[model samples]
Target: MFSLFGLTVVPAAAAGGDFAPPGCFGERYGTLFGQGVSVNCFPGEGYGYRVIAHCANGNAFWFVVGEFVPYGFGPAVAECSGALLVPARVVAYEVDEI
Candidate 1:
């Protein structure tokens, strides 16, 4: 478990095999409610990483990862709206050549 912006970020159990090349890591966010939720990976660290948002609605989205901004909201890797009850998991990974 990790802490980001006072929010507890919990990572799922590591899958077997090496997550080589693109070093991927993930954090699971609980069900989205109200105005939805915005979460960022690797806060305050400038590292090239791609973000994959897996929604409980069986839909996934991708975001271009970029630099981090202090005292400001970073790019949201995942977002939900309307009456869609979706829990999300944000994965941050570096795309490396094989």
Candidate 2:
């Protein structure tokens, strides 16, 4: 669990399975942009992964394997767009084995 602005945020991987942060996996997957949100990436059932963006304003964005990145197995950097009042957090997941 992580904390931001005194709010405790639980990563989506807690519900799915074991997931490592982008840096932990050591590969550049892609980039994410948002505000006031938390992003959680997890391994899916098979040869893919899931990205969940939790927004403060009750908005959620789900990213699949080839949507934002080429393969979906590496590290990613999250950048805030600075357009929305509430920024969202974007997390990229990486797995050692496909």
Candidate 3:
């Protein structure tokens, strides 16, 4: 286990290699009764990263990954289509070489 961006990175065994997937950590605003969903992610160092907002009504919204910079991009928010829709989960993954 190692620390990355103030978070612990645990290496897991994969089919090809043992490594830790790059991810982000932060706070998510709003609840089941809120108007919109937003996430503030402190993404790990990489080419870039994006936030995915999964809604309760099976709708998924993705925030585009901006250009790579030293400080990175700003926070992003996705609006749920249904009324009083809530976000089931917000995921942030690194946009590494592919």
Candidate 4:
């Protein structure tokens, strides 16, 4: 039923950490959840990891793994604006290490 709308949901624990953010895993992979993920601790700048969330509305989110239950991220959903159900503030995150 939901798959028909192009959604790629996954476990939350697969994309979070508290190690030095991996260089190979810089701010580029996108945002992810951390519920069933398997993270190996390594040396990072304080705490490090990446995420890549495949959302339900054909859009995904990208952010450093944060501390929370499931420790995950869903699509960047803006309020539905217009006279329909379209998102109002359609904001997107662009990963640029600088």
Candidate 5:
């Protein structure tokens, strides 16, 4: 699905590629639930990478791919930038609207 701001590059199930981080190093990219969901990200230092998540409820949740932080609340929108790319990784992202 194509989002107004971001594009849905990969499916929620995730693709078999280098996008998947070896492990959640806190400094490297990691998953939100790390079990059922495909939400991925890395730890944030000066800033967090903003991303759009496709939830099972058909609602899109705004997520930050930095700070090794757990997901926060609500459906949020964020700016698209190259900085959002996980450190030492190259994974495609898929973004969409509610």
Candidate 6:
């Protein structure tokens, strides 16, 4: 379990395969508990990562992977200014360093 911005997150760990950095895994939880979307990135045994969450309300949220468990940004219910902000998809990029 992990916590970010006051919300507890349970990460479903997996391997990102060849396209992503070695041992990197990213997860997207959309419209969490009717609140908003969340994106999490884990380096696992590899390098860092980043996430960009696209929403139905035309808003986009970006989260850079930090050195922690809930290492991303999420539950952005307030950022959309009352719009649904339904998450369309999450794009993740692997950071070879940093």
Q: For each candidate in the order shown, give its overall lDDT on alpha carbons.
A: 0.37, 0.38, 0.40, 0.27, 0.30, 0.36
lDDT per residue as tens, model 4, 55-98: 22325333333222122222212121222332222222221211
TM-score of each: 0.27, 0.27, 0.34, 0.19, 0.18, 0.28
Best-matching candidate per lDDT: 3
lDDT per residue as tens, model 2, 15-95: 322345553333223233353222334544445432333222236554323223224555333332423455444344333
For residue 21, give model 5's deviation from the true position in Å: 6.4
Clashes per candidate (backbone, < 3 Å): 0, 9, 0, 20, 9, 0
Lowest-scoring 10 consecutive residues by lDDT in candidate 3? 15-24
Task: Estimate the TM-score for candidate 3.
Answer: 0.34
lDDT of 6 by residue, 1-98 (tens): 98989999997445441133444444443444222223244534434333332223245544433332333432111111223445233333333333
Q: Could you give the candidate ranking by lDDT, starting with the highest?
A: 3, 2, 1, 6, 5, 4
Residue 2, model 1: Cα distance from true site in angstroms = 42
RMSD of each: 13.2, 9.2, 12.1, 13.1, 14.3, 14.6
Instruction: Name model 4 segments beyond 4 Å from true.
Output: 1-38, 48-52, 57-98
Model 1 vs. true fold: TM:
0.27
The residue ranges of model 5 lying beyond 4 angstroms of the native Cα positions read: 1-37, 52-91, 94-98
lDDT of 2: 0.38
Candidate 6 or 1, higher lDDT: 1
Which segments of model 3 are wrong by more than 4 Å? 1-23, 31-46, 57-71, 84-98
For residues 1-98, write the lDDT of model 5, one tens digit per residue: 55656656544555522233432211123333221223334443333333332222123233333222333322223222222233112233332211
Better of 3 and 6 by lDDT: 3
| Stretches > 4 Å off in candidate 1 | 1-22, 34-47, 56-76, 82-98
Writing each residue's lDDT as its tens digit, candidate 1 over 3-74 gives 988999887655421132222333334444412223343433353333333323346544434233232345
